[model samples]
Target: MNNNVYDCAIIGGGVGGLTLAIQLAGAGRTVILFEKEQYPFHKVCGEYVSMESYDFLERVGMPLSAMDIPIINEVKISSVNGNSFTRKLDLGGFGISRYTLDSTLADIAKNKGVTLLQETKVTGILFEKNLFLISAAQDIYQAKIAIGAYGKRSVVDKIINQRRVKHVSSEKNYVAIKYHVKVELPPNRIELHNFDNGYCGISKVDGGNYCLCYLTKSKNLRDNNNDIKKMEQNVLMKNPFLKKYFTEAVFLYEQPLTISQITFNKRSAVEDHILMLGDSAGSIVPLCGNGMSMAMHASLKAFQLIEQYLDENISRQNLEVLYHNKWNSLFSKRIKTNEYIQYLFGRKLLTNTVIAILKRVPFVTDILINNTHGSKF
Candidate 1:
């Protein structure tokens, strides 16, 4: 944070970036975390976190259990016509808003000596002489290591050649929307309802509120004249379940949180001389219901490897190679498998048939769920 070069310069302050910062700082290493937005903000996230990261988070300093968050053990999914089924989650998850989660991590990161730079937008990053020159609006700073935890999309993707690897043509057409509302959904369950071209997830977070988030093709909104409400009423409401909540839930915000050009395509874990973290590395489809945990899980991986590199336990070359392979082994298959699974979820008839088949044989559902989730870290 001072004029001196840092041990680690982290770009983006979402779940992955913040968690990495906390660990690095707590390890007695100098860290600086850059976030475009201030703390305690809302993000377009499902808010449901798989229990896999529960111990890791508490180990890093988040008193998550004492926070009194919902322990969601059941997953309820429905089809367009309202045909639905419930399955017990194998490694069930919990729910907490990004507003509470990220900000809380920011606080811990600061207390542990991380230079928490809120509202600081990083413009570019350059690697030279085994050091990183981070270009922010304020000024260029130097670091021995740099990481990108920026979510979904960023200009830095192009800056680091992350755009060269094409997985889904271009990533400029996907859109996602989210909101918090007071709904009468069961606190111990998370519901995902499917319709043509998209799906919506509902689950309880802290403060007796529910997180209502969904992802849809951008064309769905385009066809409805770019009106979110109209698109919801016409497409999402066709699910029946979405319609019921939309018509009756007490919306908590004056407006919904929306993001555009969301790309779920696979990305490289290591680019140039920078290590990618969270959504930066690879953003899995939100339908997996574990992006938050994956992002945090990634932090655990990056922090350990980077620390070994800093402690002279390994060479930089070995550090980068290990991070790449470890990240892929842990998350690559899940994201790739979900890409195909997501295609099935987008079509109404395919979703209905798939759900109906899996309903009779519930263990298949567990296999799919387990495929997407991971064991406790």
Candidate 2:
């Protein structure tokens, strides 16, 4: 037995990775977390968290309720042609930036005694003789279990599971852009404005700023000579609502943050014998507005299974199988449903028609929207 081996090693420092680290360390387990970037960094995220995770976060040392966060209870969605309608959200969410949330979670995890390694990019992982070796930068760490909490895309995906990392140009990839700005939007409302082959979500986060983020097909950027400003001016601004917001809002950044080569393809729950969490396990469409909550919920599930495995109540194989089954049962259906919805709204005509139908049958809005979210976990 290696004297320096940790009970668990986590890659990436996003919601799932951080929360899982906090839980594991809080339970008196030796845990090590690797983060490629430093804390308080911006990410290309929608920045809206569903209410399902509010209590769970408060339970895990995040004082979200005490913070003056924006409570979003209403939603406004507009079509490509700017035809729109507002509806009440049955299980509404709140808004907070990844910059704030991740950093806060990191602080909590540290206070709970988790060894967090920042600015350390993991190079590889190898499972040998039931022990895992994690190679990050120039250091190698040993652990009984490893977790892939890295989000969206990573080279580790290829290093550990070559089959899962497909060429970006070969797949139906998407690009997401995010910015924080001063905008005059209702504090209790979130808006989804649609354009050709894409949608943008805007909501007020803490610190008196709004998170303006959008996702679109990769081809949209290529078609515009790979210029984000050109794509925004020609394609996104075509929507009257988008145009008004773009023109009226005070842009806070010289350049927006971006992430590319994003795919919603089904990812395995356990990759190369390491538990996968958050977007690393599976990704839902951004328009669903539940990815943040889902990631946090997954950490809760992973923590439970990992605890049993560490306590020797469950064998490693059984632990893997149970986590896989639980992950599928909790999120597979919702991911597929959101995929279908994304496909329908990706087209201009269908998006307009769907908005019209929802307006006419306003009651169905609650059902359809609520289907994308799960109850309090």
Per-residue accuracy of model 2 over 1-377 as CA lDDT, tens digit each = 33588999999999999999999998999999999999989999988999999999999999998898999999999999989999999889999998899999999999999999999999889999999999887778999999999987888888875545766552378899999999888999999999998999999998989999999998899999999999999999999999998989999999999988888878889978999999998899899899888889999999999999999999999999999999999998899878778987757899899999999999888877888999898
Best of the candidates, lDDT: 2
**Candidate 2 whole-model C-alpha lDDT, 0 to 1:** 0.91
Judge candidate 1 against the unseen true structure and give its global Cα lDDT, from 0 to 1. 0.89
Model 1 per-residue lDDT tens digits across residues 292-344? 88889989989999989999999999999999999999987888778878877
TM-scores for all candidates: the values are 0.96, 0.98
Off by over 4 Å in 2: 1-3, 168-171
Residue 310, model 2: Cα distance from true site in angstroms: 0.7
Clashing residue pairs for model 2: none
Tell how far residue 217 is off in model 1, in angstroms: 0.9
lDDT over C-alpha atoms for residue 24 of model 1: 92
Error (Å) of candidate 1 at residue 205 is 0.1
Model 1 misplaced stretches (Cα beyond 4 Å): 162-172
In TM-score terms, which candidate is top?
2
What TM-score would you give candidate 1 relative to the actual structure?
0.96
